[model samples]
Target: MPAGYSLHDFSFDLRQHMAPANVWVTSGWTSVVAAPGTVCGVGGCFAPPYAAPDSSLSVTLEVDGRELRDGVRAGIAGFGLGLLTSGGTWRPDRIERSGTFHQYDDGRLVSLGVHSRLTPVHGAGGYVLEITVENRADRDAEISIHPRLSAGQPGRLPLADWGWMAPRAGDLVAAASTSMTLRHDLLHSRVPAGGRTRFTLAVELGEAVEPGEAARPGATEPDPADRARQATDRWARRLATALDAFPRLETDIPGLAAYWHRSIASGLVCLWDNPGFVTTPFVATSGVDGGALCAYVWDTGGYAPHLLTLMLGETATDLLEAMLKADLTKHYAIAPDGTGLGVAYAYSGWSLVTLATAVASQRGLARGLVERLHDAVAALDARFPAVGELRDYGTQHNLLEMRGAGWEHVVASPNAERAAYLDALATLAEASGAVLPVDALRATAHRIRASIADELWDAEAKWFRSRYPDGHTELTYSVQAFDALRAGACTPQMAADLIARVRPGAFLGAYGVSSVSAEDERHYELGDTDWSGGGAYTGEAPQLALTLWERGEAELAWTVLSRLLWMGEHYPYFPQEHYSDRPAAPPVGRRANIIAGLAGAEAILLGLVGVRPRPDGGLVISPPPAPGNVALRGLRFRGRSIDVECTPHGFSVTVDGRRIAPEGGAVVVPAA
Candidate 1:
């Protein structure tokens, strides 16, 4: 980390790697650094979130001892580029123009400065950097600038953005842009009042190839005024790069904490925001829908806990309180016995159950929150009375009302959804340590498990089946194995068997878990254009595969996860409620369906790391050995710091600087 500069590059290169949320900057010449083979991925250049602007500097580069010629490389993309020009009074003609070859984009001028000069900057190259202005307007503009140069490219000349910043020989720019403070890049020195401010960009050669200093040299001798700005930039880049692995899953079977998170938070957000109205029975109350589920779910359960614990540990208590307040409570319908309407028996209850347990078990919620959750569980519990139960509501899987005399295989049947609810409750109880009505909740869970085993599992099919009023099993691959796994009702072997039947191509699509199995006659094309596929454009959100991975199907889980990620990238972040029956079988993109991105992101977090938070203030850290190199750098968990680097050899973990012995490559850290 440099002293006055707010940015530092991490060894990680996202351009070649696929990550959940990546930021990069690219120009005509500079793009080679992000080219396929040389670097990791294409989107390699990006700015930090906290990138700020500086008005006191400029940048220039010369390649191989020569004043680098122009047009050789792509134009530059700077992170702190627009911050200086953002404010009207910061400096009229905020950008200083210099250089014979400089030219600005035409007609893009603002009253204070030029409108076209407005270029946005994100944390690119781990630096809160900005480009020098190109003085588009006829009049020369005096621009203060800050810039950075790193070692991601080669055979390059001094590249410059003709229309943005003037190429300077050696000037320092600010680290980031903000309202109150501004600091200059260490490399930049004040420029004279002229159009051509120049600064020589330098690079570390062969001898300095390795990191020479253990601690940052800049940290000790920081100027009082500029210290915070630089420090903030350094921290931002480290955190951004450090948390990259968790979001970018290289394999299947999420990290333990990530899995639970996908199940709870990501699950809740998706279910609440599901756009597949009438049939699927979930909708976004109000949020970005075009994303993935696992990420959203994991955010609630896994990432939220893990990151908050690591960085914002003390805020956990308050965050949980806020979460409880934001969540909505709705009544599906009420029976004569006062049991509120329940989701006939599907995946929705899993969200509620997961939340209840997470709140009670992890956060140590008081009696009020616990009791409220318990009451909901009790009412939900009552909705599924033994197996022969009946009610006037005729099976309401919430307010969606499953009204059909024929065997539609609606969720209204108690067996499936009921079991899911029980699974959630058990998880809550187990997580909370003290069960709500200890024996009663456990008893309810046991009964639900038994009912699922007796009524839902079809021996001939050798798998759990969806049910109808006639008691005929639909035998679809939607929620059966998943809910059973969640309820602790299925054996590992049973889960493995279910996985074998539902391969990604058969039952999974690019967007998410598919609704109908590829082998089924009604596969994707079957059913009505609107109210079919159980509201899912294809079928209900695929829960079967999701649960299998959560339970420990790493290899199998990755296969499904890859399909979902493919969908997210192409679909503009549609939450995969179901697959489209269109001849080509595309995904249904909706505003409320961002769960696709969420789930994909979550899979990387949960499956790879296997982070699970116990009822007691403790965490279970498990990493799966998968397809390729997996490295989880700065994973903050429960006041403990875990840095996981996975290579060809095996997994290595360091908790608070202590080498943790791998328990079969998995480690547990007691909570603070």
Candidate 2:
């Protein structure tokens, strides 16, 4: 079998690779695990309440009469096998015992390369592992490949017992607990003197109703090579579709272009569509290795808007629907066990609005879904006290309570977000032609907005401050104010003041925008990994950048975006947050944060590309007036795909392959 190409650079330095130790490839229901030293397995095989240990595959490789039980592990251990990259070399003999692992450059190598992929088939899915090896010495190399699954350990019951799998020819059958089966195929060939050879191991995991029922619907029994080709084609189409939706950056900077492509691909990987589980198709904030296997309402909400930019409307819908179906009263995070919702911060309203925006943009939300959403929002609204003369209820700090701001009692950020949610509900009701309390929602939103401008805005501080429940106001510069600004609660002058305060020495940091002004003594303080005192949260960076972009601070917006992307160069995964200080601490959470990826994607599509979806099934696009060339193609809006090209001279828009006159032909940057 020929080696399959990698969608992204899955190859990392050997030392850092074991930190997570597992590489996950998922086609919704089926999750394939590819670990460096150990064999691969299927994750989440058993249903909810039963923690099923993955069915592990162990491998043995024979080269030149030498039997290798674990080629990768042996190679890292410096047993005649060596790992080489362009910049650094790693051998067992020269292993360093101190500090960080030797960082290897990302490029080609003559020795070996391991690539893994998750591909969907008609009824089942295939996890393909392609290993390519080249003989640099002058000798013919004979290779033998062995792949088998060992019975899981006893005593752990449902999760530990690997069940019972009877191997027949090329297939493995499990009949004990759950009706599951997998077909495995190994393909390999000999390598001539100084020649290269590719080995492929394909495993097909699918559901079986009875003892010997035919393969599940859409499952196919194909050759390992054919399976790999199909999976490769599917992933290519997905990446192409996603890339067409945003501006293709033309830059001389290294890794910038790869970042754009990887960002979209990584975001899609984190979105799971498992039909086997209760929440069959929900987006996991972090993939399996990220340690966050469930969905958080706030994180999913943040992910929805960005997911829309990738033309993943169906996926975004599934996630929002799952959230609505879960216990809305305690809607905080969805447990991995699929049992009940976990309550933390009372910020479901914010997530609801994001879901509404994504649904409204699709222009095809079912009336039933809209009505259900309306009821949920109404229930959420009832939890808040009425919008009285002072609108104190609207100013409650319920939104940022999880971020260590609960002591503030009342805050403008949640009020602004509440106002935004009400506006979204009204818009969604009108768009779906549903008989919702649009008038009442609009009135409440208006009251909340009025209160934010009047009660939260401190004239002397020139910032939106929190008004204590005791009738006292606390003046603290916070990045949370950007949320209110995004909701349009601030006037023109007020917005300007906030923007000026976010300049480089204040809230802006090298990694991203800080949660609090640098001048604040508590800016560098850390609290429970939340955005309390201060931290550069990747999820919030794009929000602030987008706000600045909308306010015509194009240059500043791009600066903020550049900083966020800069972190991607250093961190292998999309970090959740970082310290505000220079040379910030290592990123928090797993390498992949769905919220951050989505937000970064949105910053490119909505902020820099200046494309906004209108409730009336139209698009409002206004690309920033920056001195760079960008061509945005394949942008889907309200069932119509549009292409946009922007240059220093002007810009052009084409709707569904036909050119249409834009409201504004070209954006001219004002002289500083």
Alpha-carbon TM-score of each model against the true structure: 0.51, 0.75
Give the distance in Å from residue 539's predicted Cα in candidate 2 to where it truly belongs: 2.1
Against the reference, the lDDT scores of all candidates come to: 0.35, 0.54
lDDT of 2: 0.54
Cα lDDT, model 1, residue 13: 20
Write candidate 2's Cα lDDT for 221-338 as tens digits: 4676576566556555554553444434444445555455545544656554434443434556664342345666777675436454344544556656767776666556665434
Candidate 1's clash total is 124
Global local distance difference test of model 1: 0.35
Pairs clashing within candidate 2: 78-92, 122-218, 122-219, 123-217, 123-218, 123-219, 124-219, 244-633, 573-591
Best by lDDT: 2
